[model samples]
Target: MKLKTYDISLVGMFAALMAIGANITSVAPFLQVAGVPLSMQPFFCILAGLLIGSRLGALSMIVYALIGIAGAPVFAGFSGGPGVIIGSTGGFILSYIVAAYVAGRIVERSQNPGLPSFYTASFAGIVLIYVIGTTYMYAALNFWMEVEMTYLGAWGIMSWFIVKDAAFTVLGAVIAPRIYKSVHRGARLGRRSAA
Candidate 1:
């Protein structure tokens, strides 16, 4: 499907927002819960999905990934480059596209994109991200990086992030519908004024 200029802008905005989210660490840097740094990207990913739907949401994430790989320091800890994309945490970064797509697809399919829909989609999407991320992490570390980590070990590491991700999921679910409505309403008004 072809995107209008406004949709394209929204996609770009989400991509930038994803980058900004990665850089924000207001909740104390030294806070260590199973060696995972808390991040806001999960919330932004779900917001993108809910606002833009599957295709645009996924496209936004892809753009974000490209920017980070291009050395924009958009990734977590302000790290970026091809090396980062191929690194151990790369799986989680890459999974953002799939996760957003899944969440957006679910919301798009729902007749009423309300709290229940958002909650379900967010939860499922987060789970999918973990699944894809954990599997890729295991393979990348053990085979590619030669770091040697069992599948369970990789999952164990991810278990720590699950709670943090869940919190973001809830935030996304609560705020997404409102933002989606406001954005679309503004789009409609713009179209009307132009017409």
Candidate 2:
């Protein structure tokens, strides 16, 4: 009734891919609130980290981005291709990779995947994503729009993004462990029955 080592690896890979798919499907268009457009993709980023661990979680996001860049219609609004990466949403899209990595690393290091710790990791990851995304956005605006963005503009951009991301983080923190445990238990049961 013992599962083979390779079986475990395969299961893990499957789980990672499932999470990636979930993330890709979860993507939404930028939310325009009070004249600021905010990217809300960081929710999936943190969820990927908490569920898949740092390396695999980050890899999932990177793979998703590459697939979209390679012309898969898997991105937000069913959009895809390299142009999207160079588009306005590019910075936020790129930040997902780092956010997942940071969250995964924090949870793994703390060795406490409990809800509170997971929430903290998710929040921290969101912060990291915002830092990178806002900075990139500012630079891109300057380069493309030919205007120096004010600090208030940057803060405004980050505000809606953070709000959406925080909502997702809270949902992920509450739901991910329950989902993981259920799936893992089911898989184990299946293995035992097979054995």
Best by lDDT: 1
The lowest-lDDT stretch of 10 consecutive residues in candidate 2 is: 22-31
lDDT of each: 0.85, 0.69
Supply the TM-score for candidate 2. 0.72
Clashing residue pairs found in predicted model 1: none
Put down candidate 2 lDDT per residue, 59-151, tens digits, no spaces. Answer: 767777787888876666667898877766678778888888888888788754678788888888888888877887787777875778875
Residue 120 C-alpha lDDT in model 2: 84
Candidate 1, residues 1-195: lDDT per residue as tens digits? 777777788899999988877867643666555667677787888788888889999999999999989998888888899998788879888989998999999999998789999999899889888888889889889888989888989888877788888987898899888888888787677667656
lDDT value, residue 19 of candidate 2 = 39
Lowest summed lDDT over 10 consecutive residues: which window, candidate 1? 26-35
